[model samples]
Target: MTRTSRRWAIAAAAFLAAPVLAGCAAGFDATTVKHYSPTEARATTVRGIQISQGFVLGPEPGGKLPKGGSAPVYLSLTNIEQQDDQLVGVAVNNAGTVKLAAPIVLPRDKRVSTSGAAAPGATPTAGTAGPPLVIEGLTKELAGGEYIAMSLQFANAGAVDLTLPVVARSREFATWAPAPAPTTQQTPTTGPTPAATATPVPTATATLTATEDASTGGH
Candidate 1:
């Protein structure tokens, strides 16, 4: 085609596409929906045992984690009793016996292995993975004792305090890193001497690179 004819054809195609594009965008505004939801007030609990899964050992607030990350306490819980109960507030104690103000949330997931996990002393196995509900901003609350302890407060369930066993938390598996091999250091002293009878000393320090056990935890 001639140059002028080609230009005219291009203009005509542009004009034809305008209406189609306009139609596609025409009802977009009306189809858009507004979203709204009211802020929910926290719930209160009446009565139920405060059960937990993972055990927080001498856990401390503001303490350092291994990977230079925010230290967090992994948690899960349930009412244990048949009847449902409300959960209210919680009190936390740091490495001391004193109490600290805190909020308690029994963030339980039915999708998880209900029976928390085996204790860390078990064999290694595939561990659980899921969205963890941050119970709350946990910090040291109380003072008096040398160790940490948390007391949960509820409206209905005053002190049906429950003890949730420390299930295994297998970052890699749902078991402990296999029981540590028994050391020979405590074997015996060839000849006993009062001052020399200290703990058995190994000639060399050897690091374990791999496990020799054939069985313990599942892959």
Candidate 2:
């Protein structure tokens, strides 16, 4: 079967159309995750697609932490082959995200993803396990030498060992800008109104009321 056909078939078989799992609850095997470095990251054939260049993120912009907070980690990927390959699917810790790519991996979750680090949330039931974590979302995108590092994961891919790479993504392909600082503005005091001051009194009468009024007048 073709790449797209293969993905649709797998998605139909495994997922039941739920939002992708996210947060620390993605349930990655801690042992397996500790070993996938770019230098040693290996690829395996699912159907016929070869997956490689795996890396785990320290923290994403908004993903929940192990015991601290949340930061959405961008899962980076690359196709080592000269031919343009198709990303069939992903199953990162049972989490999923609808991708924006033909072989997609952006926005981070689709279909269904695990929630957070063993928090008081629901989790997918365990079935037959696959060696070397294979996490996939929707779609796929990669060019030889050119890599895609976004929030999406791959279906039949990831590192054999989980020591994911800590490389930062280049700005050449970032689509969003960081949030800007808020601007502060203060209203200026109208010390003396031009119209009021301009109309000067022709004469003044000395009186107790005048003194009291003058004392109460603003500077």
Best by TM-score: 1
- Which is the leading candidate under lDDT? 1
lDDT of each: 0.33, 0.32
lDDT of 2 by residue, 111-211 (tens): 11121121122122123121112223313221112122333234544322222332222222132121122257998876765664477665555576788
Please identify model 2 stretches exceeding 4 Å from their true place: 1-36, 60-85, 95-219
Error of 1 at 62 (Å): 16
TM-score of each: 0.27, 0.24
lDDT score, residue 142, model 2?
16
Off by over 4 Å in 1: 1-47, 50-52, 57-63, 66-70, 95-147, 159-219
How many collisions per candidate? 23, 55
lDDT of 2 at 96: 29
Evaluated at residue 212, the lDDT of candidate 1 is 25
